[model samples]
Target chain A: MATIETTGLTKSFGDVHAVEDLDLTVEEGEIFGFLGPNGAGKSTTINLLLDFIRPTSGNIEVLGIDAQERPAAVRRRVGVLPEGFGFDDPLLGREYLEWAIETKEADDDPDELIDLVGLTGDADRLAADYSTGMQQRLAFAMALAGDPDLLILDEPSTGLDPNGIQNMREIVREQAERGTTVFFSSHHLAEVEAVCDRVGVMNEGELVAVDTIEGLRESAGGPATIQLECATPPTELGVADLDVVTDVAVDERTLSVTCTGASAKVDVVTHVAERAEIVDILSESVSLEALFNDLTDGGRDGDDADSEQAATEVAQ
Target chain B: MSVRTVAKQDFLSARRSRALWFATTLFALLAVLIAYGSQGYRLSATEQVQNTFRSFGMVLAVLLPIVALVASYMSIAGERESGGIKFLLSFPNTRRDVFLGKLASRLAVVAAGLTFIFLAATAVAVARHGAFPVGVVLGTYLVSLLYGSVFVAVAVALSSAVGARSRAIGAAVGSYFVLIVLYLVPTIRITALVQWVHDTMLGMEPNPHLYDAVTYTSPYIAFRKALNLVLPTEMQQEVFRGSLEAGGELPVYLTDEFSLVVFAVWLTVPLVVGYVRFEGSDLE
Candidate 1:
């Protein structure tokens, strides 16, 4: 069964369409990453799933329950680290964890959850006075209170350092290992790349792509570039028959080849070695960051006129 | 169960407030001072006790509402503005739990403060006069609590209805002006204006009962009127007492029973209005 599902979900604030016609589903025990840039409706979609805001039109179900009709019941089984949340009250870190436990009627120990989040030493301090990273860790501990079946983290690494972000990745991995489904949103491609089993990319309040990293690379069609320092440049390499090679160039003793897919690089290397003596091989794989930029940029440039038309229709 | 947990969390957090402690201590000190100063009256023991109670009640009428308002006006609105309520509602607790829990917590704080003040006053009276009017003190404490709850309900309702802390503060201070200050400070001018309009503009005879009705609309006045149910009859602060002594009957609306109803209205109406708004609003 799907842990979180939304069909045609949309939310608008006056003239602004924060989320539009969003359809999403995260299966149980799967770590699904939600990716988007700023104002791309990632957080707004999460908010709609959690029932923090009402949808303009559509349905949302979490844990197979209608979110809008019984939000508290949905939340009872789901743990959330909401975006832009703070500890304005004067409760200590442990106190907040304890409150979460008692509120959820869970039997988990507070100190253990604190230890899980690497906040054992800071659990006795006032949460309001903690640094931003410490507060994020505390919020994570609170969300882990009940060993909830599903965890929704919105920008969970907003204020973390490099080490803290690494720790967050490990904690998320550990939770998923315990058979918990994780739904996390982030603009950072590397963060999602490190832990997600599948990803959904959102742009302009609409879902642009949903696939595994490999599938995304395939659909994005980013090329792998291979450079060779050969013993000597050879003319007529006879590599023209290869389909994956997009381009090939040789200057003096150097040869550069651009191609798609992993095996194609090996194929190109073999083709080059058959014709000349090879010295050194240098290869560059496609980075998801560049792919992400391309995807979002394409959304903006390609759909500019379409979105304007939709806005006018909405206005009418 | 969720309501109780939310209430407990709110109360524990509120316990750290310096303002709550300061107000509690201040009221207790004032009670002690009133007890010591009232010893010079030459009346009988009962009369002197009644006189001291009247003076203390007057001070309490002003102080309790302000304390209640200040303590409660920021309960929901402040958290909403600071994005802390997102952390709260991220759990399984409903909006009703949050609203009623805050009301319960503020009511508990006000009740705890009243306990300190009344205990201090009773202790001093027992030490100085060698007497304790158990019924009177207890009754007066309950009445003060009801009055305090009225203001707390008003303030929490204001907090829940608005999205911003500044708006809540504006509403709270605005309510203080309209309900307490206007009734307490400019009584003579307001009364003269009402009388002039009633007699001159409308060309009608002056009705003192009209003044009583208008004044009693303020919770402060209604609270004072309700206290007559507990205090000695001679010491009761009843409106229209002069005309009643001259063979005029008091209107049912002016009776102490109706003031209790007024207290009831003030308590429930604001809560219902606030809950309706709070339940439907988006947390963003």
Candidate 2:
């Protein structure tokens, strides 16, 4: 079942198109990442679907109900960790969790979530006294209070430390494995790429691409950057054909080339070794940092224009 | 969904807030002072009810507005600021469910606490002087809450309009003062401290016409006038007044026609306005 389906969902604040004719379908029981740069309208999109703000035009169906028309009904089935709500006050951590549990009416044992979030020891301490990482853990516990079928987590890993980030990844991945559909949005693409099975990249209020995790990487140009180390220079190199060596920069004895295809990385590395002395072997995988910069920068004008057209159509 | 649960949550939330507890407690203690601290009245059981009614009436006529302000000031604003409302709103409950549930619970707490203090004042009166007239004591406190209905609406509307907690509180408090101290200044101009300004403003010739208009135009004075009608200090006279007179008629000093309309306006206008604002606002 589709938990969320929006057709041409558009929102504008005077001249600024915050979210433009965004059409998306979120299948039940899958972790979906709404990947975008800052101000790409991830938060705005969530707010519209939650009915905190009405859409300028188009339709939003969340949890099988029209969001604008039946927000209370949709809210009943959803759980959200909103962005910028990253702060809390003097309430005790465990007590806050208990209140959330009672409010959401989720059947999970509080003690179990306490352990799951690893806050059993500091359960009585005031939440204001918690470190940023500890607070993130508490927020996670709050999101899980109701055993919600669809969880909308915005920047869930914002203040987490290194280990906390790893723990968050595990928790998110675990929820997805347990058949909960997770719709997460973040400016930090690394967080999205780590746990999200599929991703939709947006730029300037428009969704440029939506595909399986592997598919987005493939479509965005597959990763290939080779590092080599050799004992001695050999003869006869540069025989294998490489796809688009866009740029080749050299630092001391190592050469770095912007190329597509990882298999081509092996070909380049073998050839480099036959030509000169090589030191070490490394393949710079196309991390989401690289992915986002390219998409937002390269696709900004095209994405914005495309989205404005869609928005006008929805308005009509 | 249960009213009991709603009340319990409200009570707990208030208990968790030490500042709110102190502010409300101070108001209750002040009500007692208003009754006991007056000059030369016989401190008897019946007089105690009359005194408490007078003091609570005056205090709550003002304090009820404050309560209404605090209640609405925090209603949606508090939730949005703390992110607590969003968490609760995401539940199966509708906006109406959350609004009424929290409101009922908060009201129950305030009412319960006020009733206890009013009852204490009555007990003191009986122990010191004579038998208690249950009707007068109960009526004063109950009506005070009712008169405060507009304050609640105004506060709630402001809360729904903006997201800043401190700004919301300031606006509600400031607006209350405007209605009381500014527009109704001539009526409240009785204190010795303000006599100099009063002399300058009135020049020994206070205009009866201006004062009457100001009184009705001011929600605060109008509310006090409403209370004076419902519970007069003349009850301390203890005459064998007719039952119909005791239950319904206004005191000789208060004209019932205008105050009743003001009270009704306070109850309805703000609620309708606030609900409309709430329906349009972004939950963020």
TM-score of chain B of each: 0.92, 0.72
- Docking quality tier of candidate 1? medium
TM-score of 1: 0.90
Best by lDDT: 1
Model 2 backbone overlap count: 4
Query: Candidate 1, residues A12-92: lDDT per residue as tens digits?
Result: 999898888988989999899999888899988987887778899999999999988898898899899988887978889
Per-candidate DockQ vs. reference = 0.67, 0.31
Q: Tell me chain A's TM-score in each of the predictions.
A: 0.88, 0.78
Q: What is the interface RMSD of each candidate, in Å?
A: 1.0, 3.1
Candidate 1, superposed: residue stretches over 4 Å from native: A221-224, A228-234, A238-247, A259-283, A298-316, B39-41, B187-211, B240-247
A45, model 1: CA deviation in Å? 1.9
B194-260, model 2: which lDDT tens digit per residue?
3344456657644333334434556776666555555655642322122223365434333544766
Candidate 2 interface RMS: 3.1
